[model samples]
Target: MNLRSLTVLGAALLLAACTTPLQPGEKRYSAAELLALKPADLSWPATSTVGERALREAAVADIRARLVLPAGPEREAALPKLFDLVAQYNAEIAAARPLLLQALPTLGQRDAETQRALLTAAHTLYATDAAPLIWPLLPQLTTSKPFAIAAYTLLQADGAAADRLRVMLPQQFPSWADDARLTALMQRLRPSAAAQPPLAELLAAPLRPGFPVIVSLQRPGRQVMGLALVRDAGGRFVRDGAGQLFTSPQLALARSGLPGTITNGNTPQGLFTVVGAGTATNPNIGPTPYLHSKLPVEATPAEFEHVPAPGAAAWDEALYDSYLPPSWRAWPPIKEALLSGRAGRDELLVHGNTINPAYYAGTTYHPGAPQQGCLVSHEDWDAATGRLVASRQLTLAQTYAGAGARSDLAGYLIVVELPGEGAVTPAEAHALVMAAGR
Candidate 1:
């Protein structure tokens, strides 16, 4: 071959060596090193939309064809070959992260039920990197204890036995949940789950699994304490009140803004029947709360399923809307101030599609903003039967969807369970109050 041709051939070989996986001691290149390579070093092949990882993967296929594996060599000898381009692999994966997160809304919402598949792709695509982006569970996702247990298990204080759960359960569970100790920890959390303010309401018609809800509260220094929990159906609680708080559920939701108001999304703690869900309402659910949705859902046998993890698929069956629910025939429309949940919308409504007296009282609504499309729960109930009736109070709030304040001073507020016999906690009583009946 001519000298120039030979040089070109040599460069191609060198590029091939840089894009594979190296187990440990092999020549691994960090993202910095890969970026420093000459254009000619790599084949300069067309890139994929999947970002760096896909690029590396595509390039690796070309390079691997030239390599030949031995029939039965010792594992150690073949190791370097395995990773000759290890750095490229790592870099590609790293680069793909922001891309994945940016495109998440489109991918995640294309179909709500398919979110798990999207998560799986996220797992395979991002791999270990996803752990740090630890998500806090949204109330709807609390329907599945296993998923909740597994998610909390992800945030191990350190890589203890508790951290190992990510790998054990069906290989589907994050290794963090596999730790025997962590599993025991999850089991321990069960007892306290029901009494926890969020847990009890979460148990009632858990919806919107996998959606993210920001739960934050201001601490002593104006420093906010909060967690972005993922929505799960497996709300933590056992029959007799003993369970673990979701990784940071208590710390995230516990807080108030003013001494006596439900500030921001700081839901007052207490036994709250998830009255119903409805449209986005601000300064309605909590004191000066952000715009959010609400829906009322009575647990239909179909909506109430036992799942290993809380997911939308759990509700794929019929809610039996065709048949009249025992309390189906009649109920008064909830008034504007009450909290009702909307089945389709998956949130507690404060008003049908309007703000409440509280927002006006609190000055949360900007005069020109037209109340920002907030809603309130109605005192909706079925009195037609004369006795207590099982009704699915519903509403839909699109709180985060609108342009509204994202952050507010937070405090440990709780939904105080009123006179009826039910679970109530200290925080709930002190910071929370039921909306004046509609």
Candidate 2:
């Protein structure tokens, strides 16, 4: 071959070496062999949208090819991707049903991580005909004690399953009924008749002393777009050049489209402490500076609220409870961050999207993209020059920096679900802030 052609071939080989998974050999892995691969190792190709799309198609094909194999660990490996695919790419595997149903009977024999994946996938596919297989296993699954959390999470996929969970709760898992985390989940299962505290009440609730608060008001529906309103430390709503409350449209849906309670689900509704600000290294998040924050268990309540936590204990349910007003204290869904943090969810942030818009063009929140349980704002980047043309996240970061007392760019973020069908308007948000007073 000519020197130029040889050089082109060398570059292609180098690219392949960098992007493809390296194991014992280049040949396809058996179901059992693939089990040894860590979930992290199964990540998307770290290139451009083309690379992402290529890996997605290849991974989906690989999973489908393995699904038809005889039932075993391959099924376990394939199971999680069912949820992952739907969550990340909105792609539902057509071949998962038979494999899932066949594997359901023996699901209890698998390990903890496998069980979690199965339960998560079962929840994702619950709307399909997998309910029968899942229902029978709920007793066995919940009885595992260790897996009861996953079982409870699975039931939450459908409201009809709520009654079943209620019946099983007292009998099957009495001890956890009053536990804060379980209580939060149960309240989600069956909402309370008590009314939501007025907007003014939540706004007036005590928060961290030094930082501004960004209140993200989303719809009860997780997928709908939401609005975030910022309140300065002095308790006044920040306004824009238009003299209206400064608001940014944000989406809290997880890339996996799972509920916030799950590992990488939607953004949980509750308080988060914005401890600092920095740019994300993740390609999906691009170069935008993210408002770094922590969930309840991830940071002590004392640290979370920028106050002295009385108890010697790092954090407890009561300490978490103390931050909210009495009205919000009774609300179950508000405890999601506390419970979710305890469940090992972490790394949630407020950042801007750098994902290729073409990928999600027709979706519900097209201009905005779902994150891995972080708050996402819309951004327009000039791809050719790799410069940010416009960014809501940078604007937010500026707002936080402007309001915070310290150099850490610290603040508070409260995510609340409003009882409505549409995005919270600037007028509605401004009026609510006005009612709360400075």
Candidate 3:
């Protein structure tokens, strides 16, 4: 054979040798195994032109091929690995749904544990994308505990989607009436449903004459970053030359879970008008209270199942009743309901961290670590400047207080969640509120 042909044959042999074969009795790759494979390895032909969605699609196809095993231990083992791959890539549900449907019949015939996993994956995909594709499958899985929990979570957090879900599948709502946990969730959800305005309404709503603050916590790519925009008296969001909101230097100094239904670690989203301000002395964080709201506390369900860990109770308590600056509170009726315990939690605040400033400066402080739910910012001591660098929380409190002094109307705080890939931008937020009024 010619040298050119021999070299091509050698390369093919080398490529085959490098590929890891399935383990003994293993029908598919494990999560670790799949995660270890690079995007290039998963993509067709190792081409750089393959986009992220295409790469994810190829991975889903590969995993789906391994799922052909019969309804038994082998297939059951393969299922989790497939799910792990799907989650890692955040695969487009539209591309992955066909494989999920193909596996359902076999999965249903398997043991209850296997069925639960399948349902959980379906619920996850639905939650991740809010895709309608999973709706048809949800009816069948409503009886599953995992599915019920998932449905309750989504329903509590999203007003528009929850309304639609109720209309589309009325039976699914009542199915969980007997479940104690779901019952509690439903009770808490009622108030949230009443309190949360529709997205369109929220987007279009006019800024109260006083200073207006709009906070958008969006999952752009993977990390969720929050942008705080303040409206001038003219009702335009303060922006710089590039059109980015003129954000406080300390932006998202701490992290929280997505906005909506209050989990201990999650920040709740809604419209709040500042009502009262006070100082509270706490042993952990010291005496530095500014403004406080009942919003976070009232918004939280009395009880919700979260992944259990140490410090969860403390984290929830802090988020529910933490202090804010003097200028922040909800409108009268909402305030009364929250205070009376008829609605949301009390003591929610825009506040600083409990950690020592000396150790925390120039560092991202996650007070509750993996489970902090409050809207918190950090204070840093700038040694060179010989001054304390205030957080966005402080800046916002001061800005609103100033705006309140100039106008009779109270300033409003609107927190909204932006889902599904940069769905909302800071500039868009200003346009939305202004357009809503027009």
Candidate 4:
């Protein structure tokens, strides 16, 4: 099959694995049966429709109860999948705490895959709570990059452990060191509260003119969260009645939870060319149309700037700096997408989530889930009817569409990591956009 067909098939299989439930009146598999089935056959990742919250909650509870099941092969095999469900839904992890604590002692005896999964689970579900447990097991799993990264996530909470992991980062994930941004990211986990330049200052970092742009502003930590502002071809922002720029909450967390320097990690902060827009075949993203964008190196500088091909330019220091203002060009954190694309991270886009928002109801970015290194705007879908209810992504697409008919749905997406701990509020975005305008 061709690449496009393969992509469709893969998305279909993933949607089936992650969301499809047993047909009406079909036999509901018991937890044991669920565990015995293959990856594609396990169907506990249920989606809730407009009014079926209770049904989905009960199903989640059933799966949570299995966390305390007798510790053995079944539990070991199920631990990763269970943790994934928890992360996917941002579900409560109180029950799984005991199970994770129980599994700690036997980690050395488990296979590397299981150990890595356990570490990942602890990182995702327990966070700092699992640090104490994970610290003791790191020596056993430090050789594996995935295991080390997951352990580092929890261990970073403890000062001594954080110091140790900082040293190991360069040694364990050596390739990451090639890009100074990845190394700097490890060192600056909790960014100092420095006064940031006005939004006008950041936007002054010159982008090619005459193309609509979607700028996503994220915190320095590269968390799966941020705010996205849309600009028209003439560099105008949509404003609220009060004349503040309209902003949408966008999630930039990648499913892999790795740094952007690696494949399938956090969304890198940089520019992307919006080459096309359309409905996604992937159920995880649902029916909302997404803007297909390509990063630098993924697209040549000519293509990236929407100009005719100049002689083949290398993705070197000069080319990378051309996209940034001279003042901000030397900063390493902002160079993530350039290095990420050079390192082979591709297929990035601005899209919406189909995963049920109830999964993340209590979280800060409620109704938004992590994507595969894409800028995901909040989108609510009625699972029963398979219909879009509300979508910030749609608004974004329409805004881009209305900007100009010249390229029809093509432009640029510039993602920047701002310096802050909280989500970028609409007020903040408005202030910045207005400041830039003035």
TM-score of each: 0.17, 0.79, 0.39, 0.73
Decide which is better by TM-score, 1 or 3: 3
- Candidate 1 lowest-lDDT run of ten: 254-263
Better of 1 and 2 by lDDT: 2
In order, the Cα lDDT scores of the candidates are 0.25, 0.64, 0.40, 0.62
In model 3, state the lDDT of residue 302: 22
**Model 3 worst lDDT run, 10 consecutive residues:** 13-22
Q: Over the stretch 229-303, how does candidate 3's per-residue lDDT look in tens digits?
A: 556545555556686555542222212222222222234444444443333342222123334433433333322
Tens-digit lDDT track for model 1 on 1-438?
A: 332343343343333211111123323222233223332232111221233234344445533432333333332232222222222232233433454344334432333333333333243344345444434322223222324322442433234434344343324434534333233334433323322233223223223232223222212211122221112223211111252222121121211111111112123221112211211212112111122222113232223322235434332113322121223212111110112122121222122211112222322221111111112222111223211121111111222211111122111111221322222233432232121110
Task: Give per-residue lDDT, candidate 2, residue 142.
Answer: 53
State the lDDT of candidate 2 residue by residue for 244-338, as single tens digits. Answer: 67888888876545556666567989988877665444556655566777898877656676656544356666777777887788777788888
Q: Among these predicted structures, which one has the highest TM-score?
A: 2
Provide the clashing-pair count of each candidate structure: 128, 2, 14, 1
Model 2 accuracy (lDDT, Cα): 0.64
lDDT of 3: 0.40
| Per-residue lDDT of model 4, residues 1-438, tens digit only | 332343343334344121133224423222233223322221222244543464345435645655655767766666665665555545656767777777876787778667766766665566677777666666566444445455456654565566666665566567855654455456355443544434576664447677777888887655536788878778787665786676778888765465665544678877678776654555566555667688788878777766676744766767777766766665665676777777666777677776666556666655567755677887655466545556787776766666643544568787877766777777777677767772
Better of 2 and 4 by TM-score: 2
